[model samples]
Target: MIKLKELSRLYNINKTIVEYGLIELLPRQHRPFSYTLMRIVLFWVRTKHQHLSLPERLRLSLQSLGPIYIKLGQMLSTRRDLLPPIYADQLAYLQDNVPPFCGELAIKQIESSLGKTIDELFENFDATALASASIAQVHTATLREDNREVVIKVIRPEIEKTIQADIQLMKWLAQLMQRFLKDSERLRPVEVVYEYEKTIIDELDLMREGANAIQLRRNFLGSKLLYVPEIYSDYCTKNVLVMERIYGIPVSDIDALEAQGTDLKLLAERGVETFFTQVFRDSFFHADMHPGNVFVSYDHPEDPLWIGIDCGIVGTLNNEDKRYLAENFLAFFNRDYRQVAQLHIDSGWVPEDTPLEEFEFAIRAVCEPIFEKPLSEISFAAVLINLFNTARRYNMKVQPQLVLLQKTLLYIEGLGRQLYPQLDLWDTAKPFLEDWMKEQVSPTNLLKKLQQKAPFWLEKLPDLPELVYHNLASGKSLQKQQKQLIVSITKQQQKNSKSYFYIGIAATLTLVSTLAYLQTDKNLAMIAGIPGLFAWFLAWRHTNNE
Candidate 1:
């Protein structure tokens, strides 16, 4: 049963979409008659933002809708494989900023989660929110034990119900798009919505976020390029998180960084390096590197350090994903479009039957112009977008696992551009990838792998002789079974041959009887017919017996 509230909400969503002229963004040829009729019926809900571009309109519409939609837009912004560069660019501007919930309520929730009052946990706890986002708000406090400054993150009150309601509506709309819209399969509305749902729901669990932060902090411990805030797990819960508060210039604050004499070029290059290190070296990366979650340290303006927070979302690549990615990147660096296409095929990212020549040609066409200019002038993200767009024509589906990586790459590229436009991404990444690739196949790596397995091998040494004996006994038994099976098959073949011989004889007798019947002599016909009947009976009996 549909509630009145839900129905009203659905109508409002439709009204907002219509007023934003989102339907007009669709091609005229693709629009169904029913869509035209609906627009005609809702003629009074004219587009209010006629001056804005389609992409701008979309961003604004999602922003106006609410935090869930804003988060959806943010997630979609990373999907260059699914959307155009322009729309994705606009969506990247969608902020997660939302008004904070009540501080009193947050305190109560925290006390309930930790089973203690605010005073027992900390000193100088601020009731006012230090920062607020869609999922949670942060409150600054000093730990009672060591007087360490920390931020208490609490999930929004009743956010689950809001998320569920909005997600259900979004799912319903996605289904409508899947059913009614042309070429909607390429967009994959339902899958995108489901992905957004999972991301948002995961963000609701602050414990997972805290754990992710801890893992990331461990990975970057004593490192120069990036720093993750320490998670205070003792005071954390599913709905609340406590972590060391970091003081750094916001990565987006270019003016402040410049005022502080930050090495912008090195900073930009280091950003790319850090991203690759997380992906290839660590295999676990902070997927959300949006400006809000990233900060620049003040201590070293010459060699700036990055402070990462809000590790609710992270991406991991297995050995295969890392290998293929490194190879593909190196191939791109070398302008080897054929290798790129072949890698995609080998990785099963594209169809096996895809023509190598045609794919290579498509890639070269899309990538050749990119190399015409200096490498520093090129956009790695743009190159990826073109490659993905071309691959889509060849029926390449979007890789869901790579969505976070792709999004992070975009964030990195944007940061690079903002920090230092001439930072050559290729130059920074090529040697790293080449060196990593070499390390993967080196003798040292082989030794390391063997050493990793040494303990397991030693544990199984006592069983080796028993395993060998069992294997030999099983082989002998298998051979005996094979010989017996061959004998059985031979007996069946002989029986078939005997039955066939009887059938041939019966056929010959029947033919002779027909010939005799056609003759004028009745005694000859009678003698032949009796023999034919006896032969037929013998054949039937023999066949049935076999």
Candidate 2:
């Protein structure tokens, strides 16, 4: 049963959907009803924003629907292939630019979370926000004890309750969609919401985000390609996080970078290299690399290093996924479309029943046009979209685990193009992929794998002989038991056969009794009926005993 608050939420959601003209997206059976009801409500509650484009309306609807819907829009923004360009473009605004809450409330929440007064905590704390996003806002501050420069990230006041309400509503909506919408399984709306729910709920804990930042910082320690800020653990909490403030040009600020005499081309290449290294080498990456979260170091004017922030959402791949991803990238670079198709089948990304030759052809057709020009001219996101579009026909399943990586790639490519439009991603990524592939098959890697497993093998070594003997004993016992079981099954089968014979005889006698009665032989009919009823009872008793 829905609560009163949830009902109210649903009413608002319906009104918003109706006002935004999204009723058209409703399933065929629901559209007419929703349209009529929404119009009736609209007469009382006027919408002044009717002049907005459909995409803009959608963006506003998601925004009005609250954080959960905004997050959904942000995720959808990455899938240009699945959505119209205008929608994707408009939805991109939800990434880090959502309207911030009041600074006074932020201070109160921070004080409450850390259990310290503002004056006691920071010698110089800026009430004005440095940046605001969906979950939290950051403010510049200096520690009172050491006067260390840092940024205080505070979760929005009472956000948890709002988030819970919106999330429950989304789950309800997803359920409705799956239950009523046509071909809804293809969308997997519930699964998508579940994924988003986990991601967002995880983000609600600033401590986890701080930990993600620390891990990423350690992963790229002493590396020139990327930089992660130091997290101040003592000042961090579930709702409030304090980290060393980072000063660098935002990655999207191309003109500012040019003004600083930054190496734009090198910057673009390093962005690609950083992504591949984070994915292939470490298997851990800062998944949310949108322009707002990425910055370029001013120190490395010649090298153009990257500084990553907001590690709330990170992505990691298992060993198998990493290996397959590396192989796929290498094959793609080499134009081995057949290998790509085979790898998909081997990885169970596509059905085993998919025709390899046809899949190869489809992949080739999608990829061939993109490679005709230099890598600099080709769009990495566009290539991925085309491949996905083609693969949809083959019933390729969505890998929800890779959704973060896909979003990261869009961010990286968009950043790369802004830094240097002529950036050759293939040129930057191919060598790294080749080296990774070589490492996978190397003797050293095999030795490492063996060494990693050596401890487990050693632990089991003493039990091996006993294990073998027990196995042999169990096998012998199993054979004897199997023979006995087979005999028992045979006896049961024989009994069932006898029961079935009785049932057949009963059915035949009943039919004969009916025919005799119809032919006016009453005595014969009575005799036949009595025997039929007796047989039926006997069969029933026999069947019950068996």
Candidate 3:
């Protein structure tokens, strides 16, 4: 059940929703044209909602909500498969670059959480935040213990209240979708929201984010593609976190990066590589890879290091999903549209009845147009958007992780475009995917899996002869039963066939007799004559043949 307060807020939002002429965006089965007509009238009544495009309306609504809604909007922005290209582009701007709370509040929160004063915790702490966001804000600081420069991230005060309220709204909307939307079961909106709810709620507690960061850092501790900041344990608290900070250029600042003589091409390629490596190898990725959350190390301009901040939203894929995704990427790169469509069906992205050839043609229709275009000219995001829209015609189920992955991919592509337009994602990603697939299917992997099951196999070996004897005996019994069953089925089928033949013969005889008698009658003199008799012979021949 939804709270009255939350319901009222939705009603107010619905007011704007009506004015925007967007109630049609909702699933049609729910409204019966009532909602559509009402929204059209509302649009005429309010000018603020009347003139905006679809993307602008989405942006405005997200902005009106709190951080949780901002996060939700950001998530939605990644789904090119579900939304319009324009909407995805506009929602990408919902990074929520708000002003941070006062430094005094930051210090107080830290002191309260750590049971120590700020003076004892750090030698130097900046008052102004480097950047503030929906969940937390960051400030640069230096630890007195080791004279190490670090950044302090503190969760917002009273964030839970707002987040919980917004989550309630999301849950309400999801329930509505599950209730009225066509194929609501496939959409699984409620489950997606629940999954997101778990992640964002965990993010509210900085300790969980810290643990996720530490695990991720350990995964790529010595690796080259990206860096996860070190979490300071002693000073860490529920709402406050201390982590080692390094100087690097933000990934978004294209001009600054170019001016610093950074190898934009190499950086962009490595960015793609880093993403695949994290997703495939580590299975834990720094999900939030926006410009503000990432930076480049200037120490090596030719090979810039990625410095990842903000571990609030991370993604993990089960081995099955990972393997399917890798295969999909490989298939896409190979321009195997049929395999892509089949993969969707096999992976259950689309319904089982989705015709493979039709889906293949649809995929090719979207992909064939941009086959040889340079990566810069072809918008990867747009291609995905088109592909997704096409799939909706077949009622394709959206992959939640793919949505996250797509968002990150767009993030990567957008960053690449900003940095180096000529960077080819396929070229960069193809080799990585190939190598990863090789590792995944290597003999070593097989051996390792078998090795884990070796003990069980060894124990079962001694009983093998007995097991085989039992199997042989059972097989003989099953064979006898099968033969008897076959005989029964054959006899029954023969009976059915003979019965059908007799029925056909009887019907034919009846028809011929009726025609012959009618031909003699004055009423059928012209219609039923020698032609009817000849037709009767032909019908008899046809029935007799059966």
The candidate that wins on TM-score is 1
In candidate 2, what are the lDDT values of residues 342-377, reduced to their tens digit?
Answer: 999999888899999999999999999889988788
94 Cα displacement, candidate 2 (Å) = 5.1
lDDT values, one for every candidate: 0.85, 0.86, 0.78
User: Any runs in candidate 3 off by more than 4 Å, and if so which?
Assistant: 11-64, 72-96, 451-546
Residue lDDT tens for model 3, 288-351: 7776678899888877888888887788889999989899989998999999998899988898
Where does candidate 1 stray beyond 4 Å?
Answer: 1-12, 19-60, 75-96, 165-197, 486-546
The clash tally of candidate 2 reads 0
Q: Which whole-number lDDT from 0 to 100 does residue 545 have in model 1?
A: 82
Superposing all C-alpha atoms, what RMSD in Å does each candidate have to the true structure? 4.3, 5.0, 9.1
Off by over 4 Å in 2: 1-7, 13-37, 49-65, 69-97, 486-546
* Residue 369 local lDDT, model 2: 88
Q: Candidate 1 has what TM-score?
A: 0.84
Per-residue lDDT tens digits for candidate 1, residues 58-112, read 9889877767777667766655545798997788676445567899999999999
